[model samples]
Target chain A: MLFEVTADPLHPQPLIDHVRKDESGAVAVFLGVVRDNSRGRRVLHLEYDAYPEMATSVMRGIAEDAMERWPLTDVAIQHRTGRLEIGETSLLIAVSSPHRAEAFAACHHLVDRFKESVPIWKKEVWEGGEVWIEGEPVERS
Target chain B: MKARVRLFARLADLAGTRETEVELGEGLSAADAFRLLCQRFPELADHSDSVMYAVNAEYVNSDHSLRDGDELALIPPVSGGDRAV
Candidate 1:
């Protein structure tokens, strides 16, 4: 139930609080933000688009995968879709586990897999142009 | 048969719309439906190789058979990244 997709700006503190637990000794957090530059271009902002229902379902699958692979106590992942300015947070993943190792490992695994499998897209807008970053390549046309 | 097709990211931009309804033969495959889409939006034909198909929100092979009223999505490579940009 923690996985979600939103069009609004993302905040990480709530996720941190949600994943916090007395039984877990360690928590790992990952925050993804839009930066000021990309491929030597001054990035003005980014626009993210998503198939909301599938994206959320995919995120939930990632959290479930992480729980199955590690001794994770809880996992929460939230990603924002829509235009965002430089340094704005776009994604957040929080994981709690009995040990730091499990927490860290699960967090890393979730992010990587989510990037590869989730149905989300990002467009990098620069001063003069914009382009979609690499995903599954659009080669046929 | 009829299918509700969804386009995302670059695909949506190419088509100038997010969703469309495509008519398919009774036994048409997902790939055939996609081909029909490409025919409607020629620009999408160029990305045929890089695209993926999802039936009912679950990723599936292009050869998967289609059913009437199924919701299909044309997915461009997802751009989930950890980098700041």
Candidate 2:
């Protein structure tokens, strides 16, 4: 299991390779990239900041939850913090399992839950000004 | 009790400091601490509805109990990028 909050770009291949095993014939990976547009505004770049202490703990908890919920061989999650340009890789998740089905499901669950629970904030640097974009809280009305 | 209250992004800017030691009354819950925080920084009042609290590095509900020397963080509604794993 691997969980990290880093400022550097996520190299998915390395993470994927690390979890690859001959017993697990399939490996699934997901990469979230910075896009050029958001909510009809043209975004120039995104600045990601995390409450590191909490962010890592939440991420690790997500990983542990994924393991308990799935029969996966290995799981790795990496998220980049700091300023990133459009098209940059901001987050990566890799999962390996004996079969492809569990790998895909675990990978999706990890990312989805991470977004919903992690304390990460992204600032949208538009042409005019930058606005902080906070992630949704765990509790919602 | 002394708890390190951490603020992130816009909340940090509004609070004027990244982290502060919040002195709380005995047997204070996370919600109680939050009320005091709002009182100290009135700017946070506007966001209290959407804010979430975390204790000991995990997201917790309003009723989560706070102990002495616990680390608490205030998380605001995320608007921009998607969640990463």
Candidate 3:
């Protein structure tokens, strides 16, 4: 499937292969990686969770929306759940189209919408403690 | 009537369980189900106003109607990470 929520670590090459085709002239990929720091704290790792059923459905919707908005040949979105250490790939978004502009726009739209709509969450494990990220109150840090 | 409820992230931590079976009366709205959940797990009351509701995996508002056997979820503000997954 092009849209997924996997506990396994994500590899971008396969998604790139999935979207690559003869008619497509441009391919855009966006990878979200786990960094070592957040808000000045040293992040040890990240733990991701999802309401899987909803997360997959929402991700597909986002991909379809991108396709409708752009002249895209294919869209693939994959997200990782469970724990990921520093530098690991947490998200992969690939879009391919006959032109660079459409591929690039769709790839950007998919990632932005996924973050806003998908039911996935991540918690940053810092040196001493862990806190949920995004949309949560600053007090949580 | 009855409903199955799912909690995630901070809501699940506060409720102490990821899933629960709730008893509800007929014609009650999603709001009523959330209110009853808060009673069962008082820790969730503080977020009653902030948390969103989902029915059968679809996002819904508090006014949405509830039915027997429906799967409901309590969604905290999503934490989709920023700059550092």
Question: Which of the numbered candidates is closest to the native, going by highest lDDT?
Answer: 1
lDDT ranking from best candidate downward: 1, 3, 2
| iRMSD of all candidate structures | 4.2, 3.4, 5.7
lDDT of 3 by residue, A1-141 (tens): 388889998999999999998999999999998888877888899998789899888888878878888888998888889899998988899999999999988887777777777888888898788886646422111
Tell me each candidate's RMSD, in Å, in order.
2.5, 2.3, 3.5
User: For model 2, what is the C-alpha lDDT against the true structure?
Assistant: 0.82
For candidate 3, lDDT tens digit of each residue in B19-70?
9988978788888888998898999898876777789998887889989999
Q: Model 3 compared with the native: what TM-score?
A: 0.93
Name the better of 1 and 3 by TM-score: 1
| TM-scores of the models, in the order given | 0.95, 0.91, 0.93
Each prediction's Cα lDDT score? Answer: 0.86, 0.82, 0.83
Put the candidates in TM-score order, highest first: 1, 3, 2
lDDT of 1 at A35: 83
Best by TM-score: 1
By DockQ, the better pick of 2 and 3 is 2
Q: In model 1, where do residues sit more than 4 Å from their true spots?
A: A136-141, B83-85
Computed on C-alphas against the true complex, the DockQ of each candidate is 0.58, 0.51, 0.44
